[model samples]
Target: MADAPLKVDFISGAVDYRRRQGGGRGQALPKALGFRKGVTPDVVDATAGLGRDAFLLASLRARVTLIERNETMHRLLAEAMARAAAESPLHGEIIARMTLILGDAREILPSLKPETVLIDPMHPPRGKSALVKAEMRQLRDLVGSDPDCAELMRVALACTSKRVVLKWPRRAALLPGLPAPSHQIVGKSTRYDVFMKLPAPAGHS
Candidate 1:
């Protein structure tokens, strides 16, 4: 039989586990997005698949807007978030920090700008990602292959004033034709390529 259809449960399971595990500014995601004491920036999760990163940011006290382009996935995320919100005071508090938008990110991303934008571009699974493979397949099922990630990258770059973070497999090749990142934060299996807005040239403004 085909793998079981994905069921999103934000209240319990891995979501809850992560919520209770706790984190700090030194974590890869937070550090890449420039998190610091007393500086929890508003963030836009451009490819808000499953709301994992978005929720993680919210759990860290960032106001996060999650833009998911797929209708089914959006509905699933909406339901999961609603359930989580009603589950308990803690989950409700984090859910309150997240706002979900359904539509093509490239078309709507410019309007709902946030200080830091996060994109986890979808690519074919490369190696032994057994534990993560299910979610990867769910991503393929939910959004299919993302041919427009580069365009979304462009939109994110144009609209974000602070920074845009692209999450990629640590060893994977960077997307072609894009400018180099201002810096990168690499972990064991993942990396975040951070592109910050260029400062105005002298006398330009």
Candidate 2:
């Protein structure tokens, strides 16, 4: 018989990620994005290298669409997600909501329609305190730098029906030609650049 799925450890910060977040138990996704209270939004995680962010989103009850291009990384993410689903108490219901896709974000993002599109491309870390984590280093080995991320941004901006939030280092420059974002949420080492879409044409509900 096949081996049982791996066990996921919620403690030790083993399965938690900094970027991808699920709905907090007592907390909810920010209300501005139309996320119903206690209801997770369907998220398209375009760069699912290690699935850390994706897993966090799942933990928060967000229905995540994880996209990865590297064959090996894809396999690892699938295994990890499976392990978490089977072993995590909070994941029983969350797993059903996540969908994994292996391909370029540029190709997958255009085909998906979610309340939000979250992008976390690999950029240079600013300081020693901002160094990449060990897990992220492993992922970097699997998938190199996101050199084509500018193009991916273009595609995401065009395809997202609601908003596109790019997670970037606070010091990093905006994607080429992109204007200042409608909103920005800054953290210690990272910032979420939120671009809201033009409202749907009037008279169309």
Candidate 3:
């Protein structure tokens, strides 16, 4: 028999636990996209799968906009955010900083001029036999493979004013036929490839 479907919850589950234990801006994600030039700029989560990363950004006080193209996933994310909002004052505040939009990020990103555009598009599997994490497996099953990651990367680079952050596998090759990131933040298993949109001109010595 097929294993029972994973429970997709944002509150009072593993997701909640992780958020509560987070290390603020010290974590890789926040560092990759937050505290840039001393600014905790607002973010557009262009591929907001499950919304955990976006929630982390919101908790650290950056306004986050989550865009999910899948109808069912968007509905679930909206419901979870609503539930979190109605829970208490603190949770409500985080939810307040978050806005959920149901649409294609490529189509929607150009309309808004955010300080940063974060693209955490799906990654290809790790290996043949290595077990896929349950959460990621569920996401892959739902959204299928990401054929347009390169295109999305191009779009994000064009849209955001300050920077564009791509959440990618640590060892995976950089997206082909795209401009490389300014630099990367390498964690144990994930990498944040940050592309600066408008880098400052260097000063003369």
Candidate 4:
């Protein structure tokens, strides 16, 4: 069979610098998702986008796999990773721990077993003002709607052995019909809905 094509773009010097900075002064979703202390489980970032969240998870020591369906975003993220690996000492180690996948989460999420699966589908912007970052607006234009978000959530919940966390706008209703989160946290403009899986049976190790 023909090999699946590579999805990410070649890393640019500038963006690579930013990725190594690893969320730097930017607002990171992991912190707001109540994973502030870091995640001990393996994680899959279903909406990888610019990879800020994935980078943060890696920095926090989670073995993270970043999934981006958009070829453009994948390329951009790849370029950023490349830049970081070349310039920053800590960058290479972090990049070593992250796996980048280019595909729909529905197709990918089921095949992997992660301790946690994270979803941060882009919601329609509440405003056309300056508060929304230009890069984010551009990203929305490129990736479009999260129409499959509900389905993606379903697959993630079934496949993950630990938990599935959904990040939503604070005002939006919870995803239809999934078990309510085992817990939740309201951030400045968003909320994290955590769904926990049953624990492993004793001596099943």
Candidate 5:
């Protein structure tokens, strides 16, 4: 029996994001990723779940690299990118600015250079009333909780020259073992913790 083709739809999804809210720094993610007028730093989305955020970043004119470790998710993301490029005019340009990689970010981060690294590891499920979105529930069922998120954060901090942004539930406690974020951008349902790397002191080896 033939397996069903993945039906992930990033084109319409990104359009919805742009149409509903005007995709820009006003959004929590772009704000946390340091998106500024005339400045679109290249970024790596370490946990490129469904590529929603990656697509958003690409639309904002940043070159984005999406990394997904889960084989199933990677396959779906790849198919989604292909479909968007073929079907959506905006996505043609978005696809040009985006790249997809298959591997665990901890292994790949050391080899790449990006201005910002975005990590949105799967956290514990939300309360009963605030049940997770359908897509998120499917992801959770497939990938389970991210147990190595702390290590992933460490690798991102070491490799990234600018900052690392982590998407987390607004009410959940910060991920343990990570230093306090330099600042945060809060949204209605989620918050982004921004950790800016300290500049090396002059004349210091």
Candidate 6:
């Protein structure tokens, strides 16, 4: 039998993240995801850990699909979205734009026909000087490292039409087996590596 799911306050966490928008690291992510003033791309957050980043994107009015394969995490995310939709004033709208899927991205990405795929795989802890947040520490405890992240990237590249974005520590090594990013958005502690899809062959499209 499986253990009971862990509980988390994702609604409150998302609220706090929203309150911090337009300031510090918060401002960098949306731009990295290709968000513009009046355009909201459809996004698939392939590794929706606790749904924080996914919520951020939806709060900016982007339609987001959150995919989490862990049953415990999936339950927690579902509850958080439900509570936010019911309690948080803007979250109703936010949750409306967000969808949840309980499955692996490798098996799921092809069917979604994603325009953008966002990957933030679990990585090793940085040097002792860099403190991992409580939420992130808890996530690492639950999910361990994402060993197949390279495969996830490969699957995302094949399915996504516009671009695939990867969030990694600024100083961390790029995922093995992936090519260099076309461009990058660097922040103080993290960076978003973007890979744009090739245009379809004229005869094929």
Residues 68-157 of candidate 5: C-alpha lDDT, one tens digit per residue: 999999999898888878976777888889899999999999899667999999987767834666666677778789999999999999
> In angstroms, how far off is 204's CA in candidate 2?
8.2
lDDT of 1 by residue, 1-205 (tens): 5777776777777867876786567789999998988899999898888888788889898999988888888998999999989988988999999999998888887888667899997864777666576766877867888887888888889888899999998998888778999999999989999999986689995
Q: In model 4, where is the ten-residue run with the lowest total lDDT? A: 2-11
Specify the poorest-scoring 10-residue window by lDDT in model 1: 124-133
Candidate 4 per-residue lDDT over residues 5-100, each given as its tens digit: 333322443344555566432234554333543335678899897776677667666688999998888887888788767856777787877899
Q: Which ranges in model 4 have alpha carbons more than 4 Å from their true place?
A: 1-39, 128-130, 200-205
Overlapping backbone residue pairs in candidate 3 total: 0
Candidate 6 overall lDDT versus native: 0.83
For model 2, state the Cα shift of residue 104 in Å.
0.8
Better of 1 and 5 by TM-score: 1
TM-score, cand. 4 vs. native: 0.79
| Cα lDDT computed for each candidate against the true fold | 0.85, 0.70, 0.84, 0.75, 0.85, 0.83
Q: By lDDT, who's the top model here?
A: 1
Of the candidates numbered 3 and 6, which has the greater lDDT value? 3
lDDT of 3 by residue, 118-149 (tens): 89988877775347777677778898777998
Model 4, position 127, has a per-residue lDDT of 63
Candidate 6 residue pairs in backbone clash: none
lDDT of 6 by residue, 15-132 (tens): 4556455522237777777777666788999999878788777877788999999988988989888987897677688899989999999999999999999999997687782477
TM-score of 2: 0.79
Question: On residues 95-147, what C-alpha lDDT tens digit does candidate 2 reach at each position?
Answer: 67778898888987766755688888887644673456555655555578888
Q: Of models 1 and 2, which has the larger TM-score?
A: 1
Could you tally the backbone clashes for each prediction?
Answer: 0, 7, 0, 4, 0, 0
Q: Which lDDT value does model 3 have at 165?
A: 92
> What ranking emerges by TM-score with the best candidate at the front?
1, 5, 3, 6, 2, 4
TM-score of each: 0.92, 0.79, 0.91, 0.79, 0.91, 0.89
